[model samples]
Target: MAFSVLTINPGSTSTKLARFEGEGCVWQDVLRHTAEELAPFGTVSEQLDFRLGLVRSALAAHDGGAVRLDAVVGRGGIIDPLPGGTYRVDPVLVDRLRLGRPWDHPSNLGGVLAFSLADPLGIPAFIVDPVCVDEMAPEAKVTGLPELPKPSLLHALNVKAMVRRAAHDLGKTWNELNCVVVHLGGGVSVVAHRGGRAVDVNSANEWGPFSLDRAGGLPVGEFVRLCFSGRYSEGDIRRKLTSGGGLRAYIGTNDMLEVNRRIQAGDDEAAFYCRAMIWQIAKEVGAQAVSVGGPIDAVILTGGIAHDAGFVRLLLERVQWIAPCLVYPGEDELLALAQGALRVLRGEEPAQDYASSVLRQ
Candidate 1:
C-alpha cells in the first residue's frame, strides 16, 4: 500500500514542496520569495497565510489537487527540546508555533502550513526531527558556568537522516552502531550519535567549527570584552556571530566554489582560511569521538558543503582514522520529511505526540 505524503520545508527565502508516494518523490518544487515580497510580514507567524497561499497555488499548479495525500509533513522548527522522530502536529504544537516561542524563524511556519493543508483533507500532519531535538547526556550539558549549560540545536533533520543512512549502508540497525554525524552547511553541527541517540553535539548556531556563515565557538574572554565595548548592538553582535562571521568575515564570500576558485588563482589567504576551517572541523570530529566513548562505527559527512569534493577530500584526510568515513552529500530534507511521515503511516514507527514529548526546561 502506498501512502502519499506532501512535505513542506520553509527556508529563509524559499518554501520547498514535495509530494511523495511511499519512499519516492513524484513531484517537487521550490517557491522562491524576494525580499520585497517578504518585507511586509512582521513575524514568521504572520507569513503563515502568505506561505500557505503560495503552497496551495503551487500544489494546484502541479496537479497536486487531483492527488490524494495521506499525510502532510513539514520541516520541524525550534520548539521545546524533544526526542527525534515523526511528530503528529496537534493543537498544542500549532499554538506554540503561532506564538513562535524561543525565537521567530522562517521554519516556524512549517507546522502551521502543514496543518492548514492537511486539516481540511482530514489527513494527519507531522513535523520531523526538528532543530530542537535534544538527546544529550546529563554530563554533556554542563559547562564551566552552571547557568550557561549547552543547548542541543543542530541540523537534526539531516543529521539523523544521514545517521540512519550510514546504518543502512552498514547493514545494521540504527541502535546497533555508534556514529559521529557531521552536517557541513552554512552552519556546521558535529554530533556524537551513540546507539541511535545524539548524546553530544556542537550546536550549529552557538558552537562547533566555523562554517561558511557562522562563527561557531569563540574565545569567551575576548568575546565578552567585545560585547561590553558598546561598538555594536545586541542584534549586530548576534548577526556577526551567526551570519557575518566565518568565511564571509575572513574572505569576501561564503560560497565554497568561489573560495576554491580563489585558491586555484593562487590566492594564498583564501586557501589558508579554507584549510583552517577544515582543520577546525577535524578537531571537532575527534572531540565527538571521545564523547561517544567507544569505537565509532562511522564518521558521516553531510549537508550542502559536503558536496564539494575537494573540501570533503581534505576533511576525510584528517578524520578517516577515527572510523570509516561515509559521505552522503546534500541535505535532502524534503525526502527525509516525507520518509518520516511514511514510517508512521506505514506503522513502521509510531508518530510521537507533541504535548507528551515536550522537554521541560
Candidate 2:
C-alpha cells in the first residue's frame, strides 16, 4: 500500500499543510495569518492551539474528507543540535521545544502540531533536518574569540532537498557531489554541503547577508550602542534584528514584489538597495564556496528571491565565475518533509531517536 503522509510547515505568518500519497503530492494548502490575527499570542509557542485548530480544519476540508494517515512529518524545530535525518517526535523532543532554551522561532510549533494530530491516529510523527541540524566541522565552530563559537543554523531542509534534486538530475546521488546552495527568503542562508553532510553554515539569525526581513550581520560598534542605548528592550532589539531590520528598515516593507514595482515606478533608491541585497548574497555564496575545498560542482540558488530574474542576473554576474550558477526557485520543503517520512516507511532510512551522545551537551 502507498504510504499516506501529511506534512506541516509553520512559517512566520502562515501555516502550510500538504498531503502526499507515496511519492506524489495529493493536495496542499496554505493558511495565512495577518499581523492582527497573531498579535494576541505572546509568542510563537503560544499559537499552538490556535494553529492546530486551523490544521485540523484544513485537513477535514480536503476532498478525501479525513482519511486515515500513515504518518505525519513536520519541519523540525530549535532543539539540540543533531545530525541530518528523520526523527520521531518523542516526549523529550516535545518538552524541550515547548520551553525554548536557546531561542524561539516559528519552527518550534512543528512538533506540537504534528504530535497533536499523529498521536490521536496512532501513527508515527517525525521532523526532518531542522534548522539546528549541527554537522559543523570542529574547526568551523572555532572563532577568533574563545568565548564565542559559530552555530550551525541554516535552511537545512531546503538546501539538502535541492542538492539531492540537482544530483538526481545529473544521474548521480547527493552523497557523491559537493555544492554550495543559497536559500533566499525572509532570511538568507548559504550552506556548504560536502558530499551529503553540511559541514558548515552561517546561522541565519547572525551571519550572512541582510535578507528581506532579517538584519543579518551588523556593525559591532553600532549594534552594541543600539543595544545599550535603552531605546529598545531585549525583545524589541531582537525583533529589530530579525523582523524590523533588513529591507524593511530601509524601505518600510519586506515584500520584494513591492520593491520591484517601486523600481519600475522610478524609485532609484529602492533599485539601489535591492541591488545591494543581491551583492551581499553573492559575497555570501563566494565565502561558502571557499569553505568547500576543491572545485564546486555547482552554485545553486533556491528560494523565493531566486524567482526574481533581475536579482538573479545581478547575482549571476558577480559569482558565476566561481561555478555554474543553478537556479531552483521556490522552497520545496513540503515535498522534502514528505519524502523524509517515506524513506523511513519504505525502510530505506531508519528514523533517528531524539537522544544521541553527539547531541548531548
Candidate 3:
C-alpha cells in the first residue's frame, strides 16, 4: 500500500506544506508569513497556533478532506543531540520542542504542528533527522580544549538523503559505501560518511568553509582578541560570524548569482572572493576524506550552490582526483522529511523513539 504522508517544514517566515503518496509528491505549498503577521508572537514557540491554522487551511484547500493520510512527518528542530533517523513524535519530544531547550527557533514548531494535525486522526507523527543529529566519532569530538568539543550539527537531512540517492546511482545500498558528501548552501557541511554513519563533520554553523553568509573557521587568536576588544556584544559577534560574514562580508551580498554577474562584469575582487570560498570548500573536503579513511567510493556536491556549474567545476578541479564527483544541485528537504517517514512506515527501517533515543545518549 502507498502510504500518504503530510510533511511540514517551518522556516523563519514561511511554512512549507507537502503531501506525498509513496515516493511521489502530490502537491506542495509555501505559506509565507509577513513581519507584521508574526510581530505579535513574543517567541517562536508562541506562534504555534498561528502557524498551525495556516497549515490546516492549506491542507483543507489542497486535499478537500478527501485524502486519508497514513502518517505526518515534520522537519526536526533544535533539540538534544541524537542519531539520524525518523523519530516518532511522542509526548517527550513534543515537550522538548515546546520548551525550546538550548534556544528557541522557528523550526521547533514543526513537530508540534504535525502532532496537532495527526493526533485527531489517530495516525503517527514523525520528525526526520533534525539539526541536532549528532553521530560524530568520540575521537572526532575532541579538541585541544576539553570543554569546547566539536559538534555534529550539519545539513544531515539533505546529506543523508543525497547519500541514499548517490548509493542508488552507484548500485549500492547506503550502508555499503563510504562517501564524502558536501552540502553547500547558506552554510557548508563537509561530512565523512563511513558506511551509513556520519563519522565526522564540521558543524556548519561553527566551522568548515566560509559560506554565503557564515564565517566558517576563523583564526583562534584573532577571534579571541576581537572578543576581548569589547567593540561588539556577544549577540553582535555571533550574528556577524553566522549571518553577516563570508561572501556577504567581502562582496556586500550573499547571492551567488550576483557575485557571478559581478565577476562576469570584470570585478576582480568578486572573482577572488568566490575562488577563495571554493578553495576553502575543497580543502575541507580533503580534511573530511582523511576522516573517512580507506577509499572513498564517491564525492558528492549538493545544495543550492551546486547549481552553479562554474563553482562546481572549480570545486571539482580540486577534489575530483579523490573520487568521482557527482553534483545534485538544490535541497529537497520536504521530500526528505516524507521519505524518512515512508522508510519506517514501509518497514524498511524502524522508527526511533525520541524518549529512548535520548536516554541512550
Residue by residue across 1-361, what tens digits does model 3's lDDT show?
7899999999999999999999899999999999999999999899999998899889899989778999999889999889999999988889999998777988888999999889999999999989888888889999889889887788999999999999999999998889999999999999999988899999877888999999999999999999989899999999989999999999999999999999999999999999999999999999999999889999999999999999999999999999998899999999999999999998999999888786233
Clashing pairs in 3: none
Clashes of 1: 0
Considering TM-score, which of the candidate structures 1 and 2 is the better prediction for this target? 1
> Please, what are the lDDT tens digits per residue for candidate 2 over residues 121-226?
8999999889888887888889788789787888889988899888988777888878889998899999888988888787778867998888888888898999
**Clash count per candidate:** 0, 0, 0
Which 10 consecutive residues of model 3 have the lowest summed lDDT? 352-361
- lDDT for each residue of candidate 1 in 1-361, tens digit (9 for 90 to 100): 6898999999899999999888888889999999999999988898888899999999999973788889999889998999999999988899998888789988888988999999999999999999999999999999889889999998999998888888999999987789899999999999999998999999778887998988999999999999999899999999999989899999979988999999999999999999999999999999999999999999999999888999999999999999999999999999999989988988889999999988886
State TM-scores per candidate.
Answer: 0.98, 0.92, 0.98
RMSD of each: 1.0, 2.2, 1.0
Q: Clashing pairs in model 2?
A: none
lDDT of each: 0.92, 0.87, 0.92
Worst 10 residues of 1 by lDDT: 63-72
The per-residue C-alpha lDDT of model 3 at residue 309 equals 93
C-alpha-based local distance difference test score of model 2: 0.87
